[model samples]
Target: MKELRYLNKYFKKYWFKLLIGIIITIIARVFSLVLPPYVNKSIRAVEGYVASGSGDLSAVKGELLEYILIILGAALLSGFFTFLMRQTIINVSRYIEYDLKNEIYDHYQRLNLGFYKQNRTGDLMNRISEDVNQVRLYCGPAIMYSIQTLTLFFCLVPIMFIKAPTLALYTLLPLPILSVLIYRISRVIHKRSTIVQQFLSTLSTFTQESFSGISVIKAYGLEPKTNANLQTLAIEGKDKSMDLARVNAWFSPLMILLIGISNIFVIYIGGKQYIDGQIESMGIIAEFIIYVNMLTWPVAVVGWLTSIVQRAEASQKRINEFLHVQPEIKNEIDKDTPIAGRIEFKNVTFTYPDTNITALRNISFTVKEGETVAFIGRIGSGKSTILDLVARLYDINSGELLIDGMPIKKLNLKNLRGAIGAVPQDAFLFSDTISNNIRFGKENASMEEIVTMAKKAVVHENITGFTKGYDTVLGERGITLSGGQKQRVSIARALLKDPQIYLFDDCLSAVDTETEEEILNNLKQASKNKTTLIVSHRVSSAKNADKIIVLEDGQILQEGTHDQLVGREGYYKELYQHQLSEN
Candidate 1:
């Protein structure tokens, strides 16, 4: 019920159009109501002629022609108003849908990485596409028909009572039973529809994950197994859909049966009164039958219309839940303070959401302005997590993180992120031209700058080898290129930004030893005056750094230059000896 209130905001925005549409709908129904009364009038005249034993048909013909023309004109007006009503209301529904979609998309952009980790991509996609469409259905045809049905009911009921009150009572007696049946069925329908939607989301999520990992599936020769898994999800979704459909099957026909019973009562009671000579004319019976027939369709659709309304309410609730979630990180209104490329971590600790393990603990360190530092540790040693914190991807659980002596939390998000150039562990690329992917780092970067950065990152020669060169369009996730090529392009993009600070999270892992040495040599010259932090597994990468911090189990186990740590009796010495022996 509360979720239905979300539509009130959209309704207010297009109230004028909605008001006009309702008025036109009422006018159309009223015109339709007029034709039934004319039918009653014509029949009564014919009855009178038969009773008086007059065979003259001239008067009847004249009256019939006059009323026929009137009814025809009324029919024309009714159709024109109906067209106007649909045009206004349906167009308003589309506009409201557009606004709602944009609102949801914008909210998604503001959410942090932690939120994304907890929710699946396909579920979010379904919420925006399918769920939004459900609400739009309620806004358009459902509202139009509901207004039309109610207007006709109010107009027809009074006339029916005036013609024959006792007959009217008999005709309406079955309606209360129909009402109760619809009310009970609607609750079940709502529950079943929600389950169907949730299963649809699960299916979407499974399909997306499967396709994204199709290469791995094929590599392992898992086609049959993968297909079986997909089929399992598909069947689950189908079962939910069948459950909802089964409920709807019982709803429509039952409503029609009730309406049929109401019609039978009208005919029996009116005929009995006529036979007893208590009714004035048989024409009233004809009019009553016409009115009851008119009421039949609207009455029958009560369950169907209620199904639409219930589905919309369920969808609105889902959208509302997503929109109302407050992001863990909020952008602050920070004072203008110049970033000096200095980072300080003071006894910081962080634990990921919904997890008991601490990812980083008591990790006190400082990277002074214009210094190059490297972190060498095993997998899951908080190396990437530390870089993630620098970007403020997730806030620290305790202690202070500072950028140029100012608390990182108090800094403007845009300003802070703008000062750093980051190359994540996964070298993600958009499905776009090679040049466009490089230009993403610097929105207004020139072609010459792109080439220069690419050359420095050792990827220019590879780009030139492609048929379209920099104009080549990439496939999804840059699948067109090899892993090492993707890494070089990612490095080139970060270099083009020319930021005050640089963070590379194991970016050179895909490159061979010779190429990695060449790229690192170039980086040494390019990043002389900037603060650079590199997370690497190779001790050779950190041997030249001003400082090397060895992390183990979320704690800083050792901190010194590479030579100072090589002979020490600690985890760093053991790792160095292993790598040295492996080579």
Candidate 2:
């Protein structure tokens, strides 16, 4: 019932079509029921003709022909209505599936970054693809067949009782018992099917992770380990599938037993009625046999429909859960005003969800308009966390982040993000032409502007040297480019944005010292008036900053000009000496 309510929105949209389909299905079943009676009537007509020795052959032939025509007409009507019902249901199912998939995708886009951080990519994929498909399958055939089964059962059961009440009662004796057994089996199947789906989701997650990290695995020489892990997941998935199949295996035989038992009872009762002269004609007995056979489908369909309902219910729960997850960060405050580039972190503290220790404790900082600030820190020192907070990727646990004296939470997210440009470590690129990748930051950037930004990043000459130049197609994640080249492209993209605040989070680390120096020189010129923040482990990278802050253990240990920090002879001086020694 919960699953039904979850899917009610889709049902409402397609209810009219479903109603039409149901009508057609009922019509088809009615016509199908009419055929058996016509068959029996035709047989009786033939027998009557044989009983009269001095036969009026033409009258008997006419009667027989009339019954044959009725049977043929009923069959034609059944086929036509059945076809219409199937087409309508199929069309509705496809439309609903398409809408559901797109809604899920749109919801995913609206979710905050923290959601992606916690959820597996493959699991989400399975929900949108496999789980949605399961729902679609249920919506179409399972729904249509269920309606057909009910229609047939209700329409035929009364006719059977009217034709031979004793026999009908005897045949129906096993029905309640069959219902109980099917209900129990359905519960078991539902439980097992849910487990099977979960295992498949886990398998999907593992496979996706392995593929995405294939390069890392090879670099670390862990291919054998990855393969073994994948094999283990595959075996688990197989075992779950086999377990579900085992349940299904028992299900069919039980259905056959129920059907067989019903048929045996009918045969016994009908035979006794014929012997006692309570019923007439072998033809009528044959017609009852046909009606009993027709009932078999409705009985068997109960099990099948139950199975589909269970699977769809399981899928619905997963999809609903995904849809219900509130993003960690959301724009709850109203925003009707514009903002300037000035930013401040006032007594802000943050602890990642599901953790006891705080990542950022009592942190406060400010960046004035058109100022350059550098953050020097070792790994895991909360430098990235500060940058993420400024971007509103994660919200602060306490205090406020303000842009241009206004709380950032009150500003429109799109407007806030539009004013910031970020270049992180391990730059990402799509499998597209170099030109398009650079144009990503500013969608409407002219070709000339793109080339100009590339030149500023010191990558124009390298790109133009290639045979295809700016039109050269890069591989996934720009695997075709060298590390330095990838970083330069990333920088060019950021530069194209022409944002007020530029964030360079170890963006220059991949390049050699000489290339880094050239790019930084160009960046210094390009960012002459814009506020910029550089996060670097190398002291040389922060040497030219107007203000440098040294971070350790999520705290600012020191802040001063480059010369002042080195003169202090603290952690900054030791880092500087180490880099100088390495050089």
Candidate 3:
């Protein structure tokens, strides 16, 4: 019910369409109800005339033909209204589905990276697809039919009571039993449907993860293991789906049984009343039977409609939970002056959400405009976190981070991020043409500009070797490209930005030393008069930096020029000596 309240906005937004649909549905039901009463009158006329021994056969024939025309007209009108009802209401549902999906996707885009890390991609996809369809079922057909059922009951009930009160009362004797069955079956259906949806999400997540890491599984020859795990998930999903189906299966039979019981009562009571002369012509009995039959479809469909409502409630709650999440990072309006490529961290500290341990602790450093600073650290030394903070992927928990002498939190997020170009360690690339991937850094970048940046990153030759050159579409995550090619493409993408500052998180890790040196030299030449930060584990990569900062255990252990650090007896010196010994 609470989740339904959240949907009021959509209903209100399209109230006119819903109202038109409802009106048409009511009109359709009214047309259906008119036939039974007219049918009673025509039968009574024929019966009375026959009982009187009148030879007015022509009159009876004329009346019968007129009755046929009326019934035909009613049926045609009913069908048209039904079509209109479906067109209006179902179209509203489609529109609402479009709106809801777009809203969710937009919110997903605004949410911080932490939210993505905490949730599975498959679970989110399921909510957007399967859960939305469930909700649409409730919004359209379920609601439409429910209203139709109630309308048929109200309009037809009094007509039945007028035709034969006692028989009508007897016909309703099965209602309480029917109510109990509906309640029980609906509860089970709702519960089982929820379990089925959850298991489906689990199956989706497992399949997605397996496909994404297929290469790793194949490399380790763990195909059998992966298949077994997938089989287990499939079985779990199938079992839950079967449980839901079983609950729903009982509904149709239960509805038929209830309707059958009511019909038995009508036959017995109406026949006895007429035999005892307590009732009038047989037409009344015929009318009563027609009214009871009218109740059949609605009563039979109650279980299905209830199942739809229950499933919708379940899905709405899940969707509501996702929509209500508050983003961890909030962007502010622009007020700070233009960026000067100078970055400073003053006593900054950060701990991830839901964790007690700090990832960065009281770390402070400054890089002046046009300076190239490199952070060299072992794994888990927080080198990447520093770069992440500079990009505002995650906000610092304490102290201040500034660019161009203004606190970063005060700077406009879009402008701040636009000023810094980053090539992450993963070197992620979307499924697009190689040229398009490079142009992502600058949306309006020309082909010539893209080629220039590609040459600077030393990936131009690779592009020329491909059959489609810049037009070749990449596979997921650029799996079609080698590791070195991916890294260079990422670097080229970043280089195309030509930002005030550049952040490279081991972007050249996959390339050979000579190639790395060549690319770095080109980067140095291209990035003149701009700030640069490189997070690297390789001493060879950091050896030519204007300044080197060595981090250990989330704290700065050393800061000096490359030559100065090599002369010191600390972690930096030890790392340099170890690399020298290895060489």
Candidate 4:
């Protein structure tokens, strides 16, 4: 219930609709209450006529027909209001469900990369889908049913007591005992429902991962192993669900047994009262029977409502865990600040949050506006980390990081990121058409612009060779294309952005030297008058840059023009010599 308090705002949001629904619910119950009394009158009319022993069948028939018509009219009106009650209240719940899912999705977009590294994709999906759905049940069906039950009890109970106090008292005796049993059973249900929800998340996670990595599983010939593992998880999930079902099974029969006892008390006690003339007529006994049975469904539904609420509370708790987390990175400035791409890092140090590995140490560099600087290094040499820092993906542990002479954090994050076109080391493409994938970098880009950028990245030929050309849809992560083709497509995507700062992180690693040289030439032209940082291992990739920095073990080792470094006897000259020999 404490967790469920979070939904108060939504309830407040749709308060008017809920109020109308409540009014309608009460009115419907009142009309439904008309049936039992009218039934009593119809029975009494027959009894009085029989006692009179008069020759007047037409009078009795007319009176009986009037009562029957009134009963039918009340039933029709009650049914109509009940329908409106659901339309008003249940629709509000759906509206809340829509709002909640959007809220969760927006929060997901704001969360930092570190949060994703610590969480599983399947669990995230489950929270938005399964968990949110559970909460919806609480918002709609559980709430609606609870209201219906309460209204029925309040309206029906008093009438029974006023008609025959002794009989009503005995008939309601089982209710208190039913309540105590529900409380005890509900505790067990809450515990079991939590366990079932958790197992569902685990199962969803396992299934999602298996499908996403199906290629890896097949390639490694581990299909049997994967199948066996999934079977194990499925078995565990089934056992947990059954545990919950077994407890729920108790609710229906328990309700029936208790309500049946109330019915028996009605028969035995109401008969005695009628025989002793304490009751007016057999109609009172008949009315009491109808009222007691009316209570049966609502009382029976209590267990279901409790189960829904318990499941919802568990799901909301999971949603709140992520909702409460503040993003690791936030923009200090809200206003849009234009970027000129003068990136500077002074004594910057950075550590990866998830792994606790220091990726950069006292790294220092500057790329003035419109300068093309290339960073060449061995693997894990902090080349990519420099690019990440400039993009403000992670703040440094110690030192100044500036973009356009402003502290990186002081610039609006959206404006700063928008001004940069970054092609990461591992080129990732969504499961979409090639044209749409390129258009992702610039949403409103024209078809001609996409083809132009694709040509510049040296992937145009491969794309046109396909049957659908740019219209060809790709598989997951662009697995449909070759590695070189994927990298070229990613390059085309960045080029389409046409940003002030271009960061190409070893994007040509898979291409042959001939194609690499051609792409480099095209990039050199496309990136004119823009600050560019190319992080690559190949000498040919960096040789034409205005300035080249050699990095080793999280620190810069050399900074010079390609000719200057090639003339000297260090890593650059050795690499140039080695590559020159291979060529």
Candidate 5:
């Protein structure tokens, strides 16, 4: 219930419609009560007519026809108002559902990268889709039925007591027991519902991962193992669903049993009172029977409404768990601050939040506003991590990371990241057209500009060779393209951005040596006055940089020009000799 309080603002937003719906529900219940009173009157009329020697029955026949018409009109009005009630309240629920999803999505966008690392994509999707759907049931059907149930009780039960208090008392004796049953059953439902939702998230994550890695599964010949795993998850999910269903099964039968007990009280007591001449006629008993039946459906639905509410609360609690989390990175400044790209890491130390792995330790370096610096190192030498810091995908632990002489954290996060064009070692592209993928860097980029950037990245020829040319649609993650072509497309995307700084993290690793040489020449012409950072294991990529920094195990091993490093006897020199001999 506390978690569900989050939706109070929405209730306020649509209060007028809810008020109308409540009025309509009450009117509908009132209309339905008309039939029982008419039944009582008709039966009394018949008793009187029969007592009048059963002659000259024309007056009685006309009166009976008139009563039937009134009953029919009341039934029609009740049905119409019931439809209106559903339309208003149910539509409000849909509106609330739409707003809730948008709020969750916007909050998701605000969350930092670390959050995504800790959560699975499928689980996130489930919260937004499946969990929200369950909550909608509570908002719409649960609320509507609850109102209808209450309206019937308030409008009909009082009349029963006014007419026959003793009979009413006996009839309602089973209700308190029914209430206790509902309370106990609802507790079980809440517990089982939480477990079921967790199972859904687990199953969703497994299936998503399987689909995304289908290629890897096939290549490794693990289809049988994957199938077996999925089957196991499905069985477990089914068992959990059955557990919830078993609890729900108690509700309807319990409602029916209690309603039956109430009817027995009505018949036995009404019959006894009539025999004692304490009741005037069978008409009173007939009226009481009609009232009891009118209440039957609404009471039966109480169990269902409780189930819906319990399940909704369970799902909403899960949603609130993520919604309440404040993002680790906050935008302190409200205005955008322009970037100049003079990046300096003053004794920087950084550790990844999720794994607590220290990627950089007391690292210090400076890249001038328009200098191309190359970092060459073995694996785990903190080469790519340098680019990540420059983009502020993560904030450093204990260091002064300055951009253009100001603390990077003080700068507007969006503006700082916007000024840099980064190409990661893993080139990711969406499932879209080739032109659209390139245009992602610059949303309004023209076809001519796209062609120019593609040519500069040495990928335009490959694109034009396709039958669809620039319009060719890529598969997921640009799977339609070769590894080298994917890297080139990613490079083309960055080139299209034309930002103040470029961070290329081994993007040319997949390209052939000849193509890599040509692409490097094109990049030299393209990155003339832009600060660029190139991270690669190849000496060739580092040879043309203004300064090459060699790293080993998170620390600088050598820092100098190509000639200076090749002339000296060090790691760079030995690597250079080995590459030269191989070439």
Candidate 6:
């Protein structure tokens, strides 16, 4: 019922079309019902004309012609109505699917990063693709077929009773039995189909993970192992599908049994009536047979609709769950206010959802405008967490973070994000031309500006060396580029944004020393009038910063200029010495 209600939102928007389609279907069914009786009446009239020895041919021919015309008219009406009904259903289904897909996509964009982190890309794809498709199936043929079945049954059953009450009652003896069988089989089908869908989601997830991580698998020589795992998932998916098929196989035979029993009962009773003269003609028996045969579709639809409903229910639940998950970071109250990039953390703390321990505890720092600040720490030292907090990726658990003297909780998220530019460690790239990827940061940026930024990041020469230059299509995640090239492209993207506050989180780690130096020189020149924060492992990366803060276990242990930190003989000094020794 909940699933049906959920589907009704889309249906209601097209309800008028659906209602007209259903009305047309009812008209078609009515025309269909009139056919058997017309044939029966015409046959009886023909019999009477033959029985009477003095029957005039001209008088009988007119009646015969009238019957033929009525039959033709009914057939034509049924055909036209059926066509309109089908067209309406198709239009409604297509429109509903369009709206649903757009809604899901828009919802996804509004979701926070944490929601994406917990969800598998393949599972999300299945919800958008497979699950929505199931819903569409229900919306289109399943809905149309269901309406047609009920309308046919209602129109035929009452007519059956009026024609021969006793015979109609006797003929329907197998219906209850059929209903029980259908109910049981439907339950089994629903259970198995749910399992099948879940297994399919798992299979999709495995395939997506394998393809996305193919390079890593090859690098580690784990292809055979990965292949074995995928084969196992495929086998499991196959088994579930077969099991659902096995359940569905029982449905057709049961329908056949019930339909056959109904036919046999109708023949026995109608034959006796004909012999005893209670029924007047063979045409009446023929008509009854046709009417009984019509019952076949409604009964068969019962089984088929059961499967559609089950699949749609499962899909609805999955989509609803995704839509219901609350974002970890909610938008702030002041949604349009701008900030000047003066950031301060006042005893801010945070813990990830479903975790006991804090990732950042009582962390505090401040960066004034036009200052180049550096955060140095070992792995798992919450350096990245600081950057994430500043970017509003996660909300603080206690205390406050302020930008330009306004609480970050009160600053507009879009404005805050728009004012900051970040180059992350992983250096993610889209499967697009180099120029387009850089333009992602600033959509309306000209080609000339993109080239300038690329040159500043030391990637312009490399990009121009390709056959297509800036138009060269990169592979997924820039797989065609070297690590350093990918890193420089990411830097170029950030630099192109020309935001007020720039964040480089270990952005120079993958490049050679000389290239890193050149990039740093460019960054220094570019960031002279803007506030920049760099998180780096190498001392050289932070050596020229106006202020360097050494973070250990989410707490700032020391803060000073490069010369002071190097001379202080603390964590920063030790890190500097270690890097110099390695070089």
Query: What's the TM-score of every candidate structure?
Result: 0.90, 0.90, 0.92, 0.97, 0.93, 0.93
Return the number of clashes found in candidate 5: 0
Clashing pairs in 1: none
lDDT of each: 0.88, 0.86, 0.88, 0.92, 0.91, 0.86
Q: Residue 304 CA error for candidate 5 (Å)?
A: 1.6
Among all windows of ten consecutive residues in candidate 1, which has the lowest summed lDDT?
Answer: 331-340
Model 6, range 1-583, lDDT digits (tens) per residue?
3865777888888889998988888888888787899889888888888899779888788888898899899899999998998999877888888898888888888787777777888888888889888888889888888888999888888888998887788878888988888778877877777787777788888889988899999999999999899888888888889998888888778888888888888899989988998887988777878888888888877888888888888787788887777665767565487767788999988887644457777978889988899999888788888888889888889989988888887887888889999999999999999999999989999999999999999999999999999999999999989999999999999999989999999999999999999999999998888899999998899999999988887788889999999889789998888889989
Write candidate 3's Cα lDDT for 246-321 as tens digits.
8888888888888888888877888899899998767777777777788999998898899888888888888889
Q: Largest lDDT belongs to which candidate?
A: 4
Candidate 4 global Cα RMSD: 1.6
Worst 10 contiguous positions by lDDT, candidate 2:
331-340
Q: What is the C-alpha RMSD of each candidate to the true structure, in Å?
A: 3.0, 2.9, 2.5, 1.6, 2.3, 2.3
- Cα lDDT tens digits for candidate 2, 1-583: 4864777888899999999998898999989998788888887877787888788999988888888888889999999999999999978989989999999998898787768877899899999998998888788988899888889889888888998888888877778987888778888888988898787788889888887777898999999998898888888888988887887777667778878887888777788888898988667777888887898888787788888888888887888899988766676666555656787888888887744457777878888888888999888788887888888888888988888998878888877788889998889999999999999989999999999999989899999999999999998889889988999999999999999888999998888898888888989998888888899988878899888988888888899899999899799999999999999
Off by over 4 Å in 2: 1-4, 54-66, 110-114, 334-337, 431-436, 444-451, 460-480, 525-529, 563-568, 573-583
- The CA-based lDDT of model 2 is what? 0.86
Preferred candidate (lDDT higher): 1 or 2 = 1
Q: Of the pair 3 and 4, which is ahead by lDDT?
A: 4
Which residue pairs in candidate 4 have backbone atoms (N, alpha carbon, C) closer than 3 angstroms, thus clashing? none
lDDT of 4 by residue, 1-583 (tens): 8888888999999999988988888888878889989889999999999999984889989999999999999999999999998998889889999999999999998888889999999899999999999999999889888988999988778877888889989999999998998899899988998898888889889989988899899999999999999999989999999999999999999999999999999989999998898997899888888988889999999999988999999999889999999988887888889999898989998999999989888988889999999998888989998998888888889999988888999999999999999998789999999999999999999999999999999999999999999999999889899999999999999999999999999999999999999999999999999999999999999999999999988988999999999888899999888888999
Model 1 spans > 4 angstroms off: 44-62, 274-282, 334-338, 444-452, 521-528, 543-546, 560-583
Measured with C-alpha atoms, the lDDT of residue 317 in candidate 5 is: 95
- Please say which candidate is ahead in TM-score: 4 or 5: 4
| TM-score between model 2 and native | 0.90
Winning model by TM-score: 4
